[model samples]
Target: MTFTRFVLSKRETTLTVVAGLLTLLGLAVVYSFPTWGGLGGMALFAAAIAVGGFPVARHAFRELWLSRSLGINTLMVVAVVGAAIIGEWAEAAIVVVLFSLGEALEEYSAERVHGALEGLLDLAPPVALEILPTGESRETPVERLAVGDRVLVRPGDRVSVDGVVRAGQSAVDQAPITGESIPVEKKPGDEVFAGTINTSGALEVEVTRLAADNTLSRMVVLVQEAQLRQAPVQRFIDRFARVYTPAVTGAAALVAVVPPLLFGQPFWGEQGWLMRALQMLVIACPCALVISTPVSLVSAMTNAASRGVLIKGGRYLEALSRVRAFAFDKTGTLTEGRPVVTDVVDVCTCGECPEDCGLQHAASVEAQSSHPLARALLAEAEARGIAVPGAQDVTLLSGRGIKGTVNGANVTIASHAHFDEYVPHEPSVCRQADELAAQGKTVILVQHDDEVCALFGVADTPRASSRQALAALRARGIHTVMLTGDSPTVAEEIGRHVGIDEVRARLLPEEKVSAVAALAEEYQIVAMVGDGVNDAPALAQADVGIAMGGAGSAQAMETADVVLMSDDLAQLPFIVQLSRQARRTVTVNIAFALGAKVVVFALVAAGLATLWMAIVADVGATLAVIVNGMRLRR
Candidate 1:
């Protein structure tokens, strides 16, 4: 900043500068004996006090008279008045200046974290290119955009609203929301969030949310709310200060009067106890104790947010530090949740047929169905270069199977339930299906008339990082459990693949909640990670609820105590490590602040600590606390 700008910048700076000048002029003139003598020195010191101490004294008076409060400001005012009574004008001036400087430093450290939050506001573009019905585009403020409006986002532009891509193909960087290092591919019907950059293609997006109602806006609101929450240690310090200040005041009063009266000592003598009382007041200031833990927590939260993990508040962060067990929902949390056909086995016992004949018949009928397993069958057939013959007179069998005529012969593709319910199959065929189901595959049988033709095996694939994350948590001695609605066989298969320590299968939503409560009872703190609406109850039941891929599910994001934006399991360990480190930092800071105060207060009571030593101990401890808290930012 320039000299002119610095002078005009902040009220604190302006006041500090003026008061600093007054103190320097008074000190210089008072020490130099060639000036207008002691009378001139006293007047200059009084002028310096008026200039430097007005704000502090006014605040102290207002708080005491209006709120009946005994704050640190009140302590400082009392000390300054006691110094003036002892004719220690230079000490009074120094106290006022140093107190102001210490407060400014504390404020600067606090604003540093708040400034990181303000950076979120700059991620979104102020204007958006609206697509008009007349086949033209107009630049419009994002605030004017409503739901269902169409907007054009060119390559390298930030998406201004949460919406669906109507037309486009490109990799959009979602690091701002999900913390994923890689850009995600966006195509027609894919969802996009606000503030993500469109990297390589122009997109026509139909906005599904208003400008103010997007995910980014809600996150900002959440972050602001988190900052306002106080940690347990911070609340303890606040309660301590409310009592400590008034107790210190009474002690200082007793030190100033009782000792002098009982010992028959003069009140204004060079050896008077007034100076000792003033030193105690300065040393007992709770500035360091009150600011330590909160600053550390705020810095930790801001740092976590920057890294793509959202910790709801200090309470959750504290609980996360103690988490000894982690429960994860199976689908979408540990696996891809998309079923794919893995194998096709021919078991036809009827008349001889072509090698891929059954698959060809299954694909022909599945191509017309919209079920997830049907799509998987069609995709597999397409990949195998098979031609699907047209089907006629298709009949939907609800949850059983589909029946249709492919080239004059009837083909039925059905689940095991269908055969068990209607057309009972041979023991060998049923045994083969059971064997496939035992291996966690969804078995679908294709029947040609009364004979089984082919069997298709499908399963949800586990993510590439699932095993590594589970192992990392296990290495940290954290118990890992999987909760899923799948059958016991299927859940066991998936849990073993991810190396989970425990697996609970066939769980209903209420059962999942009971499992979470059971874990909580076994372990003091447990965290649950899930992505679907069904996981909401269990999430709320856990000590800390973490949602995976929160970018897609608003309910998951809202319900979970912590949301991993990237939907990646790797971030889970990183979050736990960071939270543990933050908790350690807060502990160290509190220890340092209290330890320093105890040593200084003892010296003051023994009459060995000087006024200069008291000031250094108070202000220096505060600066150290601020610096220690800021280390989490890195």
Candidate 2:
């Protein structure tokens, strides 16, 4: 890389190098008194102070002027100036140099934490092959490609736009965007995101979003925003530091003056009270304590982002660690949102229905509707290779079912309630429907005029990982509850299947919010998990809102505090585990930093700590906390 790029990217490292070299140069001049005289040594020390102390003094004065408060930098500046006034030029130069180096290392540690997520910016290709109207392709910048433009992705190439596959087939590796290890099979009409690799076969994708608004770009933006937001612990430390710095400065002042004036103690010697005060000031910097919480939070957030979980801020991550209850939406959370036809019971005795069964007629009428149950019927019919003759004059029965003319006969598909209340149906068929409903299946009756033809049992099944994830949460002593709009029977069945501790059924969007609020009151900290849009109110009401299938929906990413990019319930357990670990790391870091400072302060009081020892204690604590925080990156 060029020098400019290196300096821009590794600014903290560069600062440390410059400050260290200047300090060493000053030390060499002072020690080599034979070649360079005492005057020359003094000049070198002054130069070192001028260069290394400039930034320290500048920052100190800037903060003093703008915030009307004294900071750690001000304490360092005062200590250095006092040492210089006492004719300790070498010590003053070394002190400033060490402070500068410590600050740079702290900044460098923070940069590394952010780098884990910022590296995602490079995953997407800058340009894409845009297919033109004349069946030709041109290399165009992704930014120039608008929505609805078709792009051709060749084999082994990364997809450059968030689009739908218009044609062709491929297994796209979505690890960069969704954290899915296995390559996802993509065919026509399936969504493909930017930064995903087309592993096999070529694909023609129709752009759904511009490059700037794509999933990868949005994730980077969110991660950056998350880094800027401080957790409660970090804010508390900041407040403590603001008060602690000035209080320590005052105490240092008393140690310097009160002892010599009242007790006739020496004030200028190597063991003077003034020197002890300087050591106290150096130990009082609080650099490590102020840095402890934020570094841990940033590292934890970055790690989460890398694993396909987007934590909005440190506040939410910290909140997650303490969550006692997790309220989950059943439809698209614990259970697959996509319902499928599971059972087909033929109840027709008239023998006037379709030869293959009434599935063809049901599919024919359902093809005109866009409901999820309609898709289930159509998918089943397509799977069975049953030809739909197509219905005409299709009329939606308004919250009941659909009615249409099929094969010169009136065919009506209705819900179980509608079937029993209006249409004449067999009691055995009704009993069969009850059995299916008891098993969490939604039964839709297919009728031929006045006679019931077939009972279709449609169900949205639980995700394969749902049981394991809930069990994991329960094992962690967290209460799991299912809050859904499905019927009591359906909700209870799904809750049992997923091993949820509680179940609330037949709830509207507003009711879900109330349920979450009640959970929060009982459990203290409750997390609501949903699809991010339909359950947005409940998600907002909870302490932490987690959205599933975030990679496919922008609403999910925007509505939830935490988003699992892939539709994986298993990530919930992983998030909880990571949050707890992050919390522990933060606690350990704070305790270590404060304990180090306290030990040094006691030593300073006992007249055992020197200027060099004080600087080492401060710098060493900062480094210790930084290393501990960075461990979460793994």
Candidate 3:
């Protein structure tokens, strides 16, 4: 955050400063006394090279002898030695000085980017306000707080652990974790993550995860791991560099020996090809080409991670760039995954219970179940302050519904299809259920004994950002598909609302995987985005799997190739844009690096370029590509 923090370590800084001063002094002496031509001028340049170039030369020797590897350091040291042999001390000193300065600049830039990431880690407070059972609070280190420990988050304070709010209502600003623009309302039982700020009210939250296991910590770890992962192009460059350095060295040797020996030029004359060979050696360093893709990938990945997008590796970023279609799960992905009671209609004409008692009977029977529809019914009953009596012998009829005994009467809550089996004569109730199903609402027929009690309609609403996200994908010419266990009517209704191009409904977990495979076959690349345990299969089956981390299950996160650390669907488009930009930047860098080297190589071979010109071309190309790659970090 300060200028001093941007300064690198004292050792490196001192080395660079001392080397720069010596180079400047050497240049002053050479230019001021051009007629010296003796030991005096040679001593000045030699001092500069010894002081400024020793690090590079020493590294070159170590790598060459220990690992038998030829790299940029080897190229630089060889170029310097060849220049000295040809009595070109001024050029050698300048090359070493410029190379040293470039390394210093690279080190500073890397530190700055890493410093920005460290800022994210500092957002979490080291201590927490632990609430004690004796009605007292104590400040405790975050590391000592175990799971289930109660922590009180005061207004405007950052939440220190991931947990469900035990009490109190407040608006939490989750922008740091989810990139959400608006503050989210949280109350008892609602989940809140670490590093999120509590905007209003005091909240008592029971810790659900340890400090090191929080979402923010996981994001940082994943990004660090991602940076270490090599892309396909980067791996190829690594292999190429292994062969490239020695090949260029051989080419330089041939240039030094072949022309002077065969063409009969005086070996030690000014017109000799030895000088040209050294220039070619300097020009063919390949520093720019080797660094082109990785720097860009690192910058882009870090930037995306800071914005709540976790691209697991460079390969996934490459895959994301090629994605032509995206498949999404319906529940917990497109929809809110929480059903609300939409309509409660009267279907009881047999007078088994009072007309208004239909909801009470349904609520009483459903209170014993934990299904989504049952939760909706219980929630509605609680909101209306209706008393739900306890039920006995509650039984789950898998794929159908529940049957129980409530208040000494047999009660059955089942899907519309089973309504006829229980009440075969109730044609009127069946017709009403059909009408509600046509409107994309799930209808549950409530029966008391053999008589129809009521019909309950439940529907899960789509997320606010789903439509915009799908529209953005379509604008980019990428297809969007919806895969869900919901029936055709419900799936199509939600898919249409979200502008999805295709809908595959009533799919089991395995069927969802098949759907992703089919999409992959149709479009060479497919990305699947989901936020549930059931979605793990499809997510893994897709070419690129993206999980919504905020609401997603742990299994989905582990199985996904990329994790959107936020619930915001807008991250979908942002991810696509970032991946494409990274790929484009890398392509341009490769082309520019290779093209510049080829042009300079031609100039050097034809004796049209001096050693100074070769150094400028090589180092300048490297600096240009580095700056271009750093642009993504913005």
Candidate 4:
């Protein structure tokens, strides 16, 4: 029976176990065998080889079996057999051992970098409490809960369905889905998503979506599908090795066979032809070249994970390094995504007002709801410690604004159209608000007695360091672009503020994917950065997708190759630089390893290098390349 466990769970402990075994076995073998290859000599190999070997053997077998072991392992077995048949047992053992060790190192790197998807899965809402025939609640696995099923979401619980709050009010840490840094306030009729934390308060929710269709499940499905569909870039090297092994083996045979008989040289003489061929086989293992790229990528990725970034795999890391363009989603990515009041306007005041009546009126109207805007206004009023009086006949116009009577003042909070009946804007405030609106700010109108009394300004402003990150990317020659569902006025405004080279506004989710596809035609690589539900498709379509894990939408963050845990953009440019550095390091290692093998093979053939020297050249060069690639973990 197979007992499977995650590779990362046991690496340190597993390595320790293997090392102890290897130290004992190696010591026993050396002390018992042909001239004790040195107890001291076995120690280093026991430490490096044993620790490096098990991982490789496991990975190679897993991949071979997963891919069905069809032909990938065939050529390798053939190469090893050919060498051993010709009396090169030690060389064959080294070849197999080296290849296995290399495989493990690559796997080790991957294990280190993976995200806590399993832990995230633990956040799935348990049995959803459904309304029963007798007016009581019945518990069922979320999967059994169907659309239109009324469910109860308690305080400090995760919402299980995507729907509207039929009753009750509360603040939700939507950070689970939206990656918004702060909590979002929710009230009756406001849209709520599943897999989000119910920070405070409780509510009765009408299930508008089935459990399978809930936002959390959708994200899980999307992420899994994307991963399955992603092409395995590392497999190309394996395929290359299969073809490469036979050809190299044939060359070594020709070097050993044809030349000796024709030149009247003895097969096992002091300048033995058979011996030289064995040296060629030992040097031509190709383990170093095959393992180079995947190892460093795995190492850096694991290192990133320990710090909170969640990159998908080696291919994404490779693509990220080659990126020539970077596109950002405006809200909850570059910006905080927590809408806050920035300005205030007043009209219809009969005088004797201490504060901006527009501000007070707007705040008063906004005090009744928990939307980002509602919270923004409410917070501002509260910060000023403005006491709020409960309103009567409060009516919510979803996707618009709300209306009610606050202390018989007949107050209304609305959009631009709603304000036209009450107050008129001066050129300066109008112009300024228009400018601010263009930059992605949300503007609300506060009305009193059929006149626009004040304007409340709100926005999910950019992180203080985003502009600087954009500047750095531009300097690196990567084109920076922005995409969003926000109004053109807002998108363009955000684009301008963040110094984006292009802005595509009012895009639906599908439109964002099409946009990324279109851009891929001209750009070498496009990295998408987003924060929410709207950003999911775009995140999947881009050549390289980075999510702001801390403040991005749940879907966006989970699907991204690179996730910045701090919800800040300052980490972005640094990630880009590190990726480039990793790629460069890999290239250098490959060049050094391959270049050395080619030169040494040529020397051994020309009789310029002795067999002992050949062994040194092969092992020495491979060790150097391996050491060089390990530098990426730093």
Candidate 4 residue lDDT tens string, 9-79: 55643564455455456546656675755544345444534464445455546756775542323333544
Candidate 1 residue-wise lDDT at 253? 84
Q: TM-score for every candidate vs. truth?
A: 0.92, 0.92, 0.90, 0.66
Q: Comparing candidate 1 with candidate 2, which one achieves the higher lDDT?
A: 2
Better of 3 and 4 by lDDT: 3
- Candidate 3, which segments miss by more than 4 Å at Cα? 1-10, 34-41, 266-272, 346-361, 381-414, 420-428, 446-454, 550-552
| lDDT tens digits, residue span 1-634, model 1 | 3434544476865676677777787777767865575667667667767777888888899889997999988999888888888888777877888887787778778777887877776788888999999979999999999899999999999998899999988899998888888899999999998889999999999999887878787777777788777777778888999999999989988988998899876566445688888898999899998998888999988888876778888888888888999999999889988898887888876658788788899989888899999999998889999999999888888878898899888889898767655456778877888888988999998877667788888999898889999888888889999999989999999998889999999999999999999999999899999883678889999999998777777776677788887778998888888888888988888889889989988887777877657877899999999899999988
For each candidate, the alpha-carbon lDDT, in order, equals: 0.85, 0.88, 0.83, 0.66
What would the per-residue lDDT of candidate 3 be over residues 1-634, giving only the tens digit for each residue? 4333433344544555676667677677667777873456577778878887878878898989988888888988988887888888878877887776666656666666677667777788899999999979999999999999999999999998888999999999887877777899999999998888999999999999899988778778777888788889899998999999999999888888887688876454335688887888888988889888888888888888778777888989988888999999988788887999888897677655665577888888788878889999998888888888898998888758888888888988888877666556467777888898987998887878877778888899888989998899889889999988988999988887888999999998998898899898899999999883667778888988888864224555566788877677889998998899999999999999999999988886576888878888877888888899989997
Error of 1 at 524 (Å): 1.4
Ranking by lDDT: 2, 1, 3, 4
**Residue 216 error, candidate 2, Å:** 1.6
Instruction: Write candidate 2's Cα lDDT for 1-634 as tens digits.
Output: 3334544566454554565676687677667766655667667667777777887888899989998999988999999888888877778878887887788778777667666676887788999999999999999999999989999999999999999999999999999888888999999999999988999999999999988899998998998898788888888998899899889999999999999999999898568999889989999899999888988888888888888999999999999999999999998889888999999988889765656468888998989999999999999998999998879989998878998989887889999978766687778998999999889888999988778888999999999999999999999999999998888998998888889999999998899999999988899999999999888899999999999998999999998999999998888888899999999999999999989988988988888888878998999999999889889888
In candidate 2, where is summed lDDT lowest over 10 consecutive residues? 1-10
